[model samples]
Target chain A: MKTAQKNPPAHSVHSVHKTPTNPPDILAPVREMIQACIQCGTCTGSCPNAFAMDISPRGMWRMVIMGEDESITEELFNTKTFSLCSSCYTCTLRCPRGLPLTDAIQALKRIQTRHYPEKAKKNIHFYASFLESVRRHGRVRETEFMTLFFLSMKNPFLPFSFAPLAIRLMAKGKVKPGFPSAGNGALDPIFQKARELEASS
Target chain B: MKNFTHRYFYYPGCSLEGTAKEYDISTRSLMAALEIELTDIPDWNCCGASAAAAQGELLSLALPALNLAKAEAAAQASKSTAAWDILSPCSACYLNLKRAEAETARNPALRARVNAVLAEKDLQYKGGVQSRHLLDVLAKDIGASRVGHAVTNPLSGLQVAPYYGCQCLRPYAVFDDPEIPGTMNPLIRAAGAHVFPWNLSARCCGAAHMNTHPEVGISLVTDILKAAKGADLLVTVCPMCQINLEAYQNRASRLAEEDLHISVLYLPQLLGLAAGIAEEKLGLALNLAAEKDFRFETINEPI
Candidate 1:
């Protein structure tokens, strides 16, 4: 019996309560939800992008709970972290507290990027490349987005890498080289609107 | 005083004005027949769509906020004795306007900045008006009971996967379930069609991704269509999703090496079809339909 004494029954260590210092003016709906969170970890368990997030959804909200606004704000646009959220609402539905976690994250991201202009420019290359395709053709042709994305990234071998798959898909009538098909001639005004918005922005 | 049959502000935004002309046409026609009235927001700009939001969050909100403030002011200018609500046909427009409205209601600091930008346009948001997507308006305002009464033609054999897409149910669950939504399903069934249980119904249509990463987008789309297998069509409430899923299906299907190409129809178009409206009137010809393996023209219509 003495030889089998299991190391004092292994003491349980509780985690610290880290709350976020959020701005007072954030949406009341989101604020109420964030405040009511009991750190149940249910949200963390349900988040599809949990592994992708630097501060997982639950972790981000925990920061929000402790009033760590800046930390969560920084996490929001850290595209690799929050941008891929998919807004699937898995975390929202699973939370026993009924926290509007998805909406709260959306509010935070909007507030940060709206107040700070340069932060939004980070995804310029991706969007600009895509828009350039739309601007050239009336609509967004898949072949164009691919070519532009690779070109912008300067990955010369990208198209070649996709060639085998493209050819295979093309043989199956899956790859429509000339997309947009100039359907009913509706692409012109779409381009005009794009240009206007671009100029105004 | 009497309750009006139909009255709401209409914000078509950029897409319906151009690429999604059918969405605009059908919305106008259906609203008219339903006795619902829509007030157009004059000189409305794009709701920042995939481009601006992807650029910066502030600009994203600001752009759409400009349009919202304009709508609010238009409502203020209206002498009508009813509540002013802005109805958006395009899903992107609906999401953008709704996102800005939700954020402005939440963040006073951000609201102040939006106001600073609005000052340039001399417009302001008093938060009196609400922005809603067409599906939301249908499920809530129109009521499924009313829709059920209007089904002149029932689609007995049409198995529809009610695809809500990302913008309609996501970034905010304004008027529908975010996960496993049923707003359109009830309406679809009421219009006399079968609602297929599709897991990817609310998934992203790879919106801007189709233009940013074709391979990645094709995969995203293939996953959605695959989950929606056994459906005659993938019905959507978003113009962007409709365009992405329908216009790019052949390409996406080819890459998938599976017969994942499914016809994508707008909800209004489906309803119009069920209402005994012709294809040209419902904007059917506007869609990029895959060559169907079978036709059901002779199938008995339900009522």
Candidate 2:
């Protein structure tokens, strides 16, 4: 009888080392956790936004598992599948293999923002504008955050899309007028420290 | 009054401060009515929600860690030995803080890395703070019996569909069955209201997509409103769900080609009404749906 394969090829195709041209190292942990995925359609089925996604959640995982080649990894990042994930966690809860699929999706987002910034400019700007607001006020000042996002989009007509809702929210006193006052800056230290750590890493 | 003095450290999050101000007001009013003491976590910052996750995991974990650390510091300053229960009314905030707490507790290396970032601000999280959703505290800490006892004006004829949006239930089934959550049923019944049966209780409201991708968000909201056509009011625990369900009814109606105009109110807002708390204190006037669709006198006058 063949001996039990205790540790058959520890670093298989799935365990490719981090490289500039390869998949991001940040996703390695989540990828490892989901290595047991059986190509099941549970995640894709459970995802509420999968209907609108360019690639299904199951297909995203398939790319991650078989993503040893740089081209496959590039294709994974190029798809808008992970961007549409609303962090609903439905897929994570319903996965038969109990994989951290939601986290894996999030890792894809982070990778896109960091590695493929040119492709993810719109989303990157949106999130950056949001974080800039949080960094400044410790809490998001909605109007200012929206202004920054609209400005960063470089599309003057984009604000018109939200004009109806903005008017309604303002009418209800949900959107306060006037510039947001400076916050206590209590979060400055933490934000500064986070930036430093990210830079070093 | 029965001795049910459950104390918690409250984190109302950014939405409660702005768009969902009613949720903040009603949560406080309802908690006070129940004789629950809530100490605000001093200098609590934003939980970063889904936006920060796009930046990096460190920043995502760090933002929530800052709030958790602040809660821990406040707990220590009070010289309390008991484990801290940090209650957040926003589902997104609750999940962010809970995710950080759980991740830090499970992984020592990651904890060290986060602690290193926090140490610059003279803060450190020892995983002492237990982050909880308001629904968890309501269903688990304060039982339905106590809630029922506090109801002075029972919402007898009110048909409420309890909508438990994504974050509070999923990725952590601490208080109720994640997939088929029934925690709010007892609370609705306790308020003397009929629980409207629906399968979309735990549906995704498309969250921030309401802004980023309105079409997709409106489509999801349309499905939910279509399912909840018969209900008088859809009660929600998360501010995100409340806004998404309430703010987009007009567009959702147009999309579905039906008048899916159900009044959306926070769970605490409904509970506060049943408890005889004044509408002003509950900020019921602030609710967009309540302003148009809900009738306060219907529930106020005894059936």
TM-score of each: 0.68, 0.92
**CA error at residue A98 for candidate 2, angstroms:** 1.2
Scored by lDDT, model 2 comes in at 0.86
Cand. 2 TM to true fold: 0.92
Which whole-number lDDT from 0 to 100 does residue B145 have in model 2?
Answer: 96
Return the clash pairs for model 2, or none.
none
Interface RMSD list for the candidates: 9.6, 5.1
Model 1 global lDDT (CA atoms, 0 to 1)? 0.66
- Write one digit per residue (lDDT tens) for candidate 1, span B1-303: 125544688988656754566777778777765667788887666565665554445666776787788888877777666778889987777877887888899989778767766665567776777788899888998877776766788887778888887667765777877777888878888888788876777776666555444555666777787787788888877777876776665565567776666677788877776666766676665555523432323322110
Error of 2 at A9 (Å): 5.5
Q: What is the TM-score of chain A in candidate 2?
A: 0.85
Q: Give the runs in model 1 whose Cα sits over 4 Å from its true position.
A: A1-122, A128-201, B251-256, B290-303
Candidate 2 lDDT by residue in tens digits, B1-303: 535444589999999988888899999999999988899998788999888888878989999998899998888898866557999999999999999999999999999989998998889999877899999999998989999999999989888999999899989888989998999999999999999999999999999888877778988999999999888999999988998898877787778887777778999999999999999999888877784336433222110
Which stretches of model 2 miss by more than 4 angstroms?
A1-30, A180-185, A199-201, B1-6, B81-83, B291-303
